[model samples]
Target: MNKPVPPPRLRMALIGCGQIADAHLQEAAKVDSVEVVAVCDMHMDLAKQAAARFRVPGIYDNLDRMLAEAKPDVVHITTPAHTHGPLTMKALAAGCHVYVEKPFTLDAIEAETVIAAAESAEKKLCIGHDQLFDPTWLDCRSRIAAGQIGHVRHIESTLGYPISGQFGAVVAGDPRHWVRQLPGGLFQNTISHPLYRILDLLPDLHPRVEARWDRTKYDFPTELWVQLRGAEITGSLTFSSSVYAQRVTRVYGDQGMLEVDFDAQTIRRHTAPKLPGAFGRLEMPFRQWREGARNLQRNLWRFLKCEIHYFSGMRNLMAEFYRSIQQDTEQPITNAEMLRVTRIMDEIFADCRSREERVEEFVPETRELEVVR
Candidate 1:
């Protein structure tokens, strides 16, 4: 009998050559079935640098030229948030599956249009909500599915950004940066990370949203607080630039709680102690030590396997996306999920604007005034 045939390799190309593009390229290299055929960027120097680092043969300063010349089967759009919608539509039109980096689009309307284009083109579309695929998050989901946490009651997602970080500094220095032009300003560029967590755990697709925006700690409004309520669960999201960089999500269930720390790549499960009163208090430290030991062992194993890097989640997501395209299976992230998150973000920003306007109206003197020397 003849052996079964293997599927042909896939040709992948990247459209943006920014810092995030390196993560995409490095992760793509781990997928055995895909090849980095080309890279394109508005800045030719950035494109050339990426090609040289990844050993990609084709590089171009124009998307049309790269699409025509490289003939890639998949294109990864890691450009700024504003360009996501148009670039995705163009890639789908060019007969290529697309993986768009997040803040999927500026608004839900654009998200709907781009997704429709991908559907019309009959190609797979994936978003860069890779945090959901992180090892810690994966373990948390598995534990929840196994009834370790019972029914979830509430979720809190927090993302802290340091204003001194590379990207943050860029935005701070350039008054006209693309992020500043976003409706939600800097928050629009990052809130998606924390927001996606709540949307995934909450059953409601259209949750009621309330938001407050403030800039007490920075020249621009770099802090956001959002509250969302679904049918059975309530969630809150926090994005702060004043705080030290941290990424954490906590899910509280009837029986216990699960906390995932993205910055440390660890998860901790909490539950009521068997002992009562003072005994329970005494047992808490021991329980924490056990949890820490478990996390250490798990991370050590992953480290030995060379999977302890920052972009491990991206690698998993990219592999799944490529496999979906190869086998004609559903994409890892549903179009509905993408649209729901976008819509919620839109509602949050709208509320934030209204609140800001009310604040300005109530306290006219509080508004910034030009100081004369």
Candidate 2:
């Protein structure tokens, strides 16, 4: 087979010199058709530090200055969630396609505004919902598409993170952290990952959200359950602070089930055997063992091939975003998907906050009625 021709080189600039900027730069370096021309941060020293570290050609403390000078074909927004909408608008206005990190904005309205700006500017806006493009994640979708897993009846996505992780530690230490300012608190910052995974399988663009925050268990909410009711498929997202830190999504299909574990980077399928119940039960363990062995072998091969990167999904996502630019094709992650995820998040935040207010109001009324009695 003939190797495909390479796309023309495109200039790229990165904003936000936070922890996530490193990930973006690492992935950008892997994309052969793109050059990291500039790095920007609100602080010049930080911007200079990142520019030096990545060997980027230019550094700027202002978005407009960088955009005018770098004249990049694409801009990567790695800033905080609160800053996403404005940064996206700035980039799109500057005539550069934007690749923004997830939790598109603080609310759906903000998301809609940015989408409109991107559309008006005739540019593509791709969010960093990178998990959906993962190798195991893609394999699961392919199985469902090929009818190997039958029809997907439902999906369950779970994110179990530690309350004492490096980032969480910063938030825990100070109420003034930007994450705490989010309407849904830390949940808002992280829930987009698993929720998008479930949303990708559902047919409906809009889903009914029923969520409850469990804060009484501790000083702050450490567990949350969001029930999503879609047209044909129902899904749930569970975010909890637990001792076991793991990430997994299970797709419940009619013929069988598939589980994608992000932490282990493994995909396993479970199916009913054609034999009798007892024999099927006996064979199931062997089937599982075989799958485990297969995954191990695949990982070994990938490691030896040097195709294993900690953030391979992030790398692949950038590659496709650039491909869209090169081919003059549709975005890898469509603008519609970005809006849907944000809308769902907006619904969740509103529901949670409204319920908390209702509870407080009811408590005062109940106390008054008790005194009257």
Candidate 3:
């Protein structure tokens, strides 16, 4: 066979012009080989707004119309969770590589269907779980691989959002918010961020899980906790809209505990507790002060060097997706991994429903048993 030549640049089209689409567009702007040929939304106002802001050449209120006209090499799906499956399938059938936002689909069956379509179309599919592309997470994973933290036993990922914060307040004001209608409620929109990172370190085929979803202050169940049990390792995801805003993950290994702050882009390790209480207490403030200074220096340096960008991980992921399409390489996030995350979510939602009044609403448990293709 003759060697394939990579295209000069990939024409890109984006669907859904909501808050997240701006992040996608900003990131795409940072990448060199992807061109924003068009923008699509059910609302013409949204489409026109995005086009005006992003300098996109084409604007359409319908996806099929844009796909047919733009003939984009890549379709960035930024639609709601429920629409991901159909849109992804449509793009894949159009022979366009797909970059979809997280919560790949409402359920695992839909995820499998999208995966199969991509395979049949001979195109690449990338999910929007950009946290794995984060420099802090990668550094932490590398340390774990080097056994800097010893044998991994458990991980706890905590994501806190102030419900009254800018976006949350808006969602709270509307009773008909898209997030409130999700099968997993608030979790459906946010849980995937941490679960994908957790699943990366703890990949269990038949993992056991325990979960809880409840509302203490918020009108809806804004708090969620899901624990996954593997034979060798266990992981937990705690997402709360009421807590003070923070994103951090803790890795409990035999040698020590590794703490990673995603927003701060800092990783701190705690070795086996050897220091005496009084001395450790005396040294703690200095240690924290030094660490803070170091983090500030690192972040400032990265920003000065143009190494830092908002939603940088998302940008890195989009760039990698384009590279995979051009070079015929493996996807940045594999379909199997995407399916597993959806399956895990399925189990949690099912379990939560069975406990609450929402039982019988979740898809059957059989979907969680999907095999890797």
Candidate 4:
């Protein structure tokens, strides 16, 4: 008789038990190829609680000890930004694939180090830029690529939120301890997603930091305006954490434009004329009226209920990770792409620090035109 085949060996560990760790746990539970064998956190109690909550067999306050004993196939690093680089290197050295949270490191050099370690260890490294996996983003990208919008000329991406004092207070209370330590504030913490997504859609694009400004008086910069120059296109990115609550992206091409309101699960397309002529510049009366009505309805609907149409792209993100592992292929959001994004962010932060500007400078000025009486 043939010898019994041993069970497939694929164990995993969670390196941080913070709020986002729950998102990791929820996604990991849905994947069948791996088992969560252990969890580790700087706080022993947090580790134990997470292990119990996830029904894992091992728990430790020390990451090194956990790695040595658990010998997990993958280690998810949801720790603070400062710890991400070191924790990732340690896990990679121990022969474990790493899934680090967004803004992989505090700076580009540190991010490069993590990338180098992963390359040397011959293990996979993925960053959590989940917005790239959103259904609306995917659809928009597909349409743009298929020439539905023709040659891409430019793009505009914006994200913001409003809660000044309360927001700072919440960040201060978090003992995970690194948010306060990081050099850049909301720009690094929040806006990195849109900055990266815009690049992902236009891979050949090389953005030059034409201008950097800020306006908020927080400990770190809260807004950024970046201009990117590609081989044949130019784009602008505006990111902030100051608006009451708004997140929207628009991509423009020679033929048309695609607008995505991910928070509202709506996609709007404005197609240009197929042939240029005197009538080409004329706006179709019915189309204009329809668009105005649709915009009003969407705003009113979203105002009534905050969570009505928000599309959580968690499922797609998980699927991509699993597929990357199975196919042994580079993911859409590869380590290289992540490093590029980090580098751009690092440059922005450096520019802001060197210039010593206030956050309000980065905030974009919009005409306060009334949409409703």
Measured against the true structure, the TM-scores of the candidates, in listed sequence, are 0.96, 0.94, 0.90, 0.80
In each prediction, how many residue pairs overlap at the backbone (N, C-alpha, C within less than 3 A)? 0, 0, 0, 9
Worst 10 residues of 4 by lDDT: 364-373
Summing lDDT over every window of 10 consecutive residues in candidate 2, give the lowest-scoring window: 213-222
Candidate 3 stretches with Cα past 4 Å from truth are 1-7, 273-289, 357-373
lDDT of model 3, residue 239: 89
The models' CA-based lDDT, in order, is: 0.92, 0.87, 0.87, 0.75
* lDDT tens per residue, model 3, 256-283: 8789999888888777435688887767
Model 4 pairs in collision: 214-358, 214-359, 214-360, 214-361, 215-358, 215-359, 215-360, 216-359, 216-360
Best by TM-score: 1
For model 3, where is the 10-residue window of minimal lDDT?
Answer: 358-367
**Per-residue alpha-carbon lDDT of model 1 for 1-373, expressed as tens digits?**
9998878879999999999999999989988878999999999999999999999999999999999999999999999999999999899999999999999999999999998888888999999999988888988999999999899999999998988899999998888999999988998889888999888899797889999988864678888999999999999999888889999999999999999999888889899998999999988888989989999999899889988889888888998998899999999999999999999999999999999899879775554443321
lDDT assessment of candidate 3 = 0.87
On lDDT, the candidate that comes out on top is: 1
lDDT of 4 at 198: 75
Which ten-residue region of model 1 has the weakest summed lDDT?
A: 364-373
Candidate 2 lDDT by residue in tens digits, 84-179:
999999999889999998778888889989999999999988899998888878877887888877988899999987788988778777878898
